[model samples]
Target: MPDRIFDFEKDFAGSLRCIPMAVRLKLDLVGIKLSLRQWSRLDRDQRGRLLEVPCGGAADRHTIGAMIEEWVTATGGTIDRIDPADSANWSNTNTVPEVVVLQAKGEDVSAPSLSQWRALTDQQRFALIKLTRPGHENKNFVPAMREFGLFLAD
Candidate 1:
């Protein structure tokens, strides 16, 4: 695990408050999926180390899941399962966050499978969500997708 630092000021300033990679890592570590708006509610220190802790590429699904559980336990936040009833509402196009939706506009449009998405760490999923928005620069999108092991068939 390398010392991954997130520059909040440089990356998420003004209208584009992109979710920093560090915070993404923390969200993954915690296991419970979070919206960007939810992430915005966390305190500074909680946000800071999201990138500080080194989660190496060697991390597998089980290891990542366990780490996420541990992080949530230590942080005192309850992890809830996504309700089956709420499945239809999970990615409601009408209710999707503006920033996230913006990232998905105009690309090879195809939604990732639920199982595939679920298998990914929250950080990876978050990165994909952010990158796939409507108006985002395409250059960043492919790199982000590649880094997260997404769109293998393309």
Candidate 2:
């Protein structure tokens, strides 16, 4: 299984201080909300395992979800379960969500065309959606776009 952590996240991926986008995507897939405090409780090895595990099917999601809940609770942290259905936006290759477009425009980058959006991997789409949400730091938005080849030449 591939670890989908993005290149932009490499700065803190070693320490696992911040939750990498890959884990965030997995959390969405498994319907578990992992708090940063909870994530901090895990060592680098554990965080690495989370990145390495694949959540490709129903059984995989179940195993990861149970493992996440168990790990968080074992570390005296809580797991908030979210409905992954809300994450459907990333899976839709047809329409590029407005939020993602607007956020890109706000960054002085052009919105990705439908063809460009369709070309992205699900994890890339997930990262873009998460990076574009209101209140997200967004410092990495353009870099992620560039990495994904969704950014146009300036």
Candidate 3:
């Protein structure tokens, strides 16, 4: 909700080296797959629209989904859906999920306690879930945690 860009994203902000959280959230809401190529095809105005678009109401979701389809098609990209179970995992906050705990252990970092995990904003939680997913490169997991203020800045 803060519309904050992480310091880790600064290198990519100018060239869109990676898909930012704002655009990723929009893609998630619409059940669309967006490749970096498709993202590059979008002009600044289009990317700005993604960052600013409202996707809260049911009607808004429909409209945004349609808009994303059109953009993806125009860019010669394909669409895809994330599994509901995987999506649901991000919203669960009752405890720190084991995968994340394992990821932290692998990194030799302490997994946050349940209260710290619960206190994270949905976006922060979502980012952590995305980062810690098995077989993911996971290069950004620690950086995301630092950006989310779960760890001190170096």
Best by TM-score: 2
lDDT of 2 by residue, 1-154 (tens): 3456688778876467889888888888888888888898987788888988888788998998888888888888888978874567988988999989899889988888999999988888888898887776888889889999876557
Please give, for residues 1-154, the per-residue lDDT of candidate 1 as tens digits: 3333223224552222445654444444444575565445545554554545455443543454455456556666655543212222233433443443344444454345455555655445545554554554545655554444546635
Number of backbone collisions per candidate: 14, 0, 0
Poorest 10 consecutive residues by lDDT, candidate 1: 82-91
In model 2, the runs with Cα more than 4 Å from the true position are 152-154
TM-scores of the candidates in the order shown: 0.36, 0.92, 0.84
Candidate 3, residue 21: the lDDT equals 72
Please write out the lDDT profile of model 3 over residues 1-154, one tens digit for every residue: 4444567666776445568776676577666777778777877787777777776656776787787778877877765655312446666888887888888888877787888898887667777777776776888888877777777756
Go through the candidates in order and give the C-alpha RMSD of each one to the true structure. Answer: 10.3, 1.6, 2.3
Deviation in angstroms for 150 in model 1?
A: 17
Top candidate, metric lDDT: 2
Question: By TM-score, is 2 or 3 better?
Answer: 2
